[model samples]
Target: MGTVDRRSFLAWLSTGAVAAATLGRGGSLAVAEAERGATAGEVLVLRGATVFDGTGTGATADTTVVCASGRIVAVGRGLPGGLPAGARVVDCSGAFVIPGLWDAHTHSTEITPTVPALHLVHGVTGVREMRGSPATHEVRRRIERGTLAGPRMVVASNTLDGPDSRVPGATLIETDDDAREAANAARQEGADLLKVYSFLPRDQHTAIARHADRVGLPFAGHSPSLLPVHEVIRRGQRSVEHNYGMHLSTSVDAEDYFARLAALPDEPTDPNWWGRLAPLWEREAFRTYDRGRAGALAGLFAEHGAWHVPTLAVESAYARHPTRFLDDDQAQERARRWLPASLREQWRARVQAWPEWSPERAETELAYLDARLRLVADLAEDGAPVAAGTDCGSPYVFPGVAVHDELALLVRAGLSPARALRAATRDAARCAGIADAGTVVAGAHADLVVLDADPLADIGNSRAIRAVVTRGAYLGPTERQRLFDEIERAADGSEAPQPAGPAPASCCGPPPE
Candidate 1:
């Protein structure tokens, strides 16, 4: 894995260069104050934009949204009364307003304020941190206390796995006692959820589930390899990340596949045994997929209220379309220019390490990707809740920007543009168990994105950000440009940041012994 110098990154952010760049010209003091949540009594109005409220309803035209004290006070066509005195109003004519997006799965806090700041720059106002540590906890605290300019964060405990854990630093749960202790520890540590991994023993997994239930902490992540998907769902996994076991579950030969998986050695000789094996399993599952079985599975998810976060962006980059960076010159250049040097080098090494695929193998992988996309469509059709997540911080998955890519992928997978938008906004918020967010309405957080074009017409238009309103601060074109400039400077190493520590393990990579 790559390493980042977080201390250096923080130093760069604190430097006068950044401050001067952001505040020197075209910067609003009110915008700066609002970002720090110091605009307690200030009112900001977004007028004349069409509002996509994220409630599955059609967009409302000519809407006016009033925000104060970091919350939306009113949203309507025209306030029955005139605007409040001393209110700062933005004329959003011809723009489309939508709820700020959420990256439902991220390890961004490992990089601290840099990743979080990028999320804000991309109009991602909230994130669910997939793995939490003392550092991440402190980052969240700072964001909430108005001392940091970042997104609202929902953090999960460090991953829990069985003996011979795939990830380094994961809490190993070999016995029921260990499971119970881990669950309680997560709750005591104030984790938003307890994250489980694929290698846990069945009994320990069950114990953790029950204990989390009793302790009122939601448990989520990969379905344990020792158990069937139905059993995992039955045990009340709040959300399944990456559609880990679904392809097998929906296969016509699922029982046989499960038997084969169960017979594999628990302690494999190869560290990435599962990673090497999963594609073969997925390809076979795709060929044998049963529509009836898939429909039933989707129905079960809906009935149980289990949410699915298909982080297709990372999956595509690393698994299904490993050659994307090699094939797309523009993409390669963008990644090289944007990623920190260490991270870029690490990702390049990983990509080069992939075995060269023959034409037939490449086609097979593409077909498997198609199958996954169809699976998402089937789930959406069957009323199974689907949320957009990019699995950012993984190899080749850029933070913040990938959320938009995931939305586009969802649309390509047969979801309407509006439904895709909801997956990133309302559905993502619900999946993360967050309240009073992900929608534009009275009493919700004043987090919004103003787009130059209608997102409902073209989900790609989401990238056409005219302005961003977060923490009751309106970051118009000028403020937004300043932010982009600062990020560029940091990315180019013009502002020297010192290396801090080892990079967190990639969510998709093989665990270190």
Candidate 2:
């Protein structure tokens, strides 16, 4: 596949307004706002906040974020100078405001209706859903029309899995012909990318990749069963959806975990987790040493330009903690109370399918889980581009809410706060093909969040959201109140207490220069 170099991509972008607009995957009414700059009549301004643009730009304080239509017209100082006479103003004086975030890797069978809560509650403006169904596009269309509130989705058609696997909702492939056919189908259906799952023959995987590239789509996902990790990456995989599948494929624990599951006479021959396996985690406990082999996967991924998406929280909540996540004070209520009913049913079934929910399961998986997390760190240190995604369909993955948890895990994996935030915003934007999101720069979309606290200080400061401005619509005191009223009219407990009050004027927290 011919890759778009960054400079040419930028040149193509600067050609015309329409060219830039075309790059935007319109979401809700915000697309219209993004096309037009913040003009006189109806602009939203966030004055005087520190910006953590996901581009590793560090933090710039005393800046103005001007929004009109829905896209940003100005960032940094001296902006909003021509704020069309009666524009709305949001004072973010003592706050940290940055681009809206993305949950880059997600897995779902059906388009659960409750994902809207994820968008509204978390500052998540977009998501890349790995496994999608017919209803998935329908849901996306509904959200695009503003009939429903949900994250802007970059959806792939479905897994082109190995022949015998019986992937739940994807278009299946058994032969190279099937892979090519599937590629055409995915391209024609407006699928942003094509995913090759485990079991696809190496030839089929390459065929799918060739077909996708020919059609201007990116091919990514699980490394096929027969192809070694390097071969898959060198073939131009845009991303690898999960972390462990490649490394653990030939390792001892893999055989024990998969082959020994049913015929297990004793615990497992692998001493991977050993005494520790019976403690912290559950089924995924054992992690044996295959340092030389595993390290190669990282190097190969880096050399081949593949990014890593670790859905650490999703796996942890569903496969490791078992019932504990449901009881987690910060997570379960949100999942149960807000997740759409249909998805909730799937969640119930998922939890039920786990191995006997015993304390031992957690023990078995703990060491491996920790090891996997260390794997994440190793990948990062090894220079692999890593991102955060919460596969919300898994048990206890409350949408929007869980990404904060995902970020926490990423930070735990040795990413600095700035880097972790970038993985969520800027890095994901680049990977998912979104333009200039995750930063506060002129000409970027005006998807902004004002935090009451500084995230770079402790990382958890991301939770201190004082206001949310999606597109050019500023969620100052009055608008938040209106949204709250609407939410309340729709249902009880829809309203979180509004922030104390608006900050000072002049967007930069002082008079405009």
Candidate 3:
């Protein structure tokens, strides 16, 4: 919970000067010995917080949690007897303590300079980045080396899509050999996971999955148009993202629906292909949702140990209140703070240039989103593992802040507050295959959030962050505020920038004919 002036903070980041010489794992002092600091191997105690350990054991009150060497050393009723002589202690009499939250989906690169600081202030200690680039890799490297302050990151390879892919810099794969080559190349670049994208052919998807499995990398992404949900799960797709092909699979006319989708050209010449097809997808999927089939799919997910990252916050926001997401002045200003000026204007131009939705069209999309949400509820009720994800870096989806919104949305989808919290914490960790994070327990990483309010009482309280401890680097209340203040200053310092490229179209809206 240390505070530094803005100039000094920037200096510290560039040069490795720290006020405390705290030890990291293996008793290596992470900083030079300094005055008035906790000694090497000394405990740091958070005393008297109501603890939600993220394992669903419910809350334990008046507990003391101790950290040393970046790991939780003990959790008990009071400071353990024979505490170290120089233990650092923080009073947490009425605070709520939980494992640090995870945003199961995020995107980061040089364009988002404030992403790390923004995420830290909001207590997002871990992120599952949906795509990777050299810039993104540099960001992770700095964070892992303690040269930057940010979340623990797990990055996927550059997206693998068919030739008509819309994503910038996507690897275009066609045949099975192409997919295998791409997967091997990504693995060689040290990707933590594979991100298969829309329009991937069935044979290529199979080849990528087989190669990822052979190389011990878990594959999780869109269910390709030709791959049904059940088939994806059966083929060992680790996690399904964003409810892409799931809607078709839950409909009564699943076979016909999937067949229709699969029959589309592998690489459509029209740039508006996905947008043009979205209405049909929404109409049929929402109208024909078979509750029985949804229930069965949920069971199948559980049986196969598959997981879901629904990204409810982004999709529902776009569907129900597109204006709030796209045109809100306050949100735009915040985005400016968190993203570089050019990126901010790029996002703004996209919103301004997109075709407008009629009231009826908006309502229809909302109804469809609600149906999708109900499917999430059904899946959770049937024991299908769910993780909270906000597609941060998509238009208007603010990093760090949106995950809390996601948790609330999950609660609205019929999960208990406790269960919703788990989706962002424990279940999210398990889904990402990260064993050491997402819990506050002995030997776990000391990534934790201390809140002024009880999250179990209300999911919104997850945002009431009083402090965040990530990788044992503590950001006290003052430090957290400083982070936000600096982000605002950075944004305010910049001149407005010109848009970088063509205005982006809406995710579901049709292109101009």
Candidate 4:
């Protein structure tokens, strides 16, 4: 993995310098977005229906939640009893309600040019952008002020990697001193966390980590090629990204940082096939990160209490998709319509493909992934404070609908639907260090959801959403339908965001008086 330094980070904070002069800016009026979201919070009522708190306490049916001013003032049976003469009301009709979903891992600013596409449409109430450029600073501003209609934004500013950091939009680094400076710069630029990239030298990673600790900014990203997976955690990186490093620690080489690093190059191609094959194909499997080892690492983190945001959703996408979801006609149409052509194009290109193991080498990839998954399951079971994340809707990953996909993958890994939901919801909140949201309880934020089906019965049912609430403003029936209508059009290949006026003003209807 590469280390970050302030100079590259500074350049990132000043994005136009690195980005191409666009063919032309797209439809986004980004300048107007942030100021728009600062509007007053509204009132919402999620009446009746079953409620899952994402707290593993089973659930309660026929509950009531009254929200206004961005906080819930009351929650119980028949809140506000009868509304005041002009107060709003919404009947749940016995659907299920739970905390809105979250994707701990995401590449946001580049997903779609329009603010509404991410905030209003996708079900993700919160997401962590694993990789971004300094341009993303605008993204944070817009979402915070409510100019954009997307989920709450938590960014790592830019992915930090080596001088040849494999990505066009990342902040590249090369030394420990550089890493420290970079961490400071990202922190000053308002980044929520330090997103480390894979393929860095072990010692440099350690140095960068020391910087992260000194600056009070938690570090989270890929494991280093040269370091043992447990060693990096022991050194105190807030979290491990995918199970990427887990395999590196157990690989044949004794920290083959440079050699193996090149093998796992950003792109899958290798000019020297024979040379690469010797080291890569001849690589040994990573069997496990037993409780003893994983626990020790977890213990170190618990002491400083770092977090782990597993982009588990990406694993499933790679396992089931061919880079982008474009292969699926339904998914493809959706991207072209709602997404900026540039971003949509990014998803389909092979160069942007996630790491893939050939179909002929299916078992090999599966075995490696299985080992990683097992360790994650054990971590969750052992209370490792994990968060659910996705690399979805970034190019080939579809937006507005991938959160459910992530939840199902978690269930398959042995999480009860409730536990899996928490990974996305409650645990994600903890990872981001935000506590005022993520639950539908009174005195909390009025961010909530109404599902037509029970997600606990089947994680996929999370998409059976009837209503959505951002802050205290609710997406009434008409508005929810409008969002889905846009989705249906995207899947079928039609126009992009239709001219739907402002979202509806009811969730279950308005809050009862």
- Candidate 4 residues 1-513, lDDT tens each? 122233432232123311321211221111111112223234355667687866667777777665545655445454433232333567886788888666777654443344335445555677776654555666667767876556777777566766534445455677777887888888888887887765455556776778888888888887654456667767777667666555445444434633555555343265443223322422243542345555655555566566666566556555443543545787666565666554455456642334554564556545655665666776677667778776654445554466677677778778789888888787777776678667765445567778889988888888877778776667867886676665445433432332111111110011101
Quick one: best TM-score, which candidate? Answer: 3
* Candidate 1 structure, TM-score to reference: 0.86
Candidates in order, TM-scores: namely 0.86, 0.77, 0.87, 0.76
C-alpha RMSD of candidate 4: 15.2
User: Model 1's lDDT to the true fold?
Assistant: 0.75
Candidate 3 runs further than 4 Å off: 1-42, 109-112, 265-267, 270-279, 321-327, 492-513
Q: Give the runs in model 4 whose Cα sits over 4 Å from its true position.
A: 1-41, 82-86, 110-119, 250-283, 287-304, 320-327, 351-359, 484-513
* Ranked by lDDT, top first: 1, 3, 2, 4
| 231: Cα error in model 2, Å | 2.1
Give per-residue CA lDDT, model 1, range 1-513, as digits (tens).
112133432332233322333321122111222233233366787988888989878998887776777777566664333333566888888999999999899874555445667788899999998888877888888888977667889999988887856577788998878888888888888899999987777888888898888889999998876577888888899888886778888888888887876666665576445533543676678888888887888888888888889998876765554545766777676566555666666667766665666678777767877888999999899888998988887666888889998999999999999999999998898889987889987667899999999999999999999988887788889988887766665664532222222233334532222
| CA-lDDT, candidates in order | 0.75, 0.61, 0.74, 0.59
lDDT of 4: 0.59
* Model 2: per-residue Cα lDDT at residue 181: 84
**Candidate 3 pairs with clashing backbones:** 1-476
User: Whole-model lDDT for model 3 versus the true structure?
Assistant: 0.74
Q: Higher lDDT: candidate 1 or 2?
A: 1
Give the per-residue Cα lDDT of candidate 4 at 272.
43
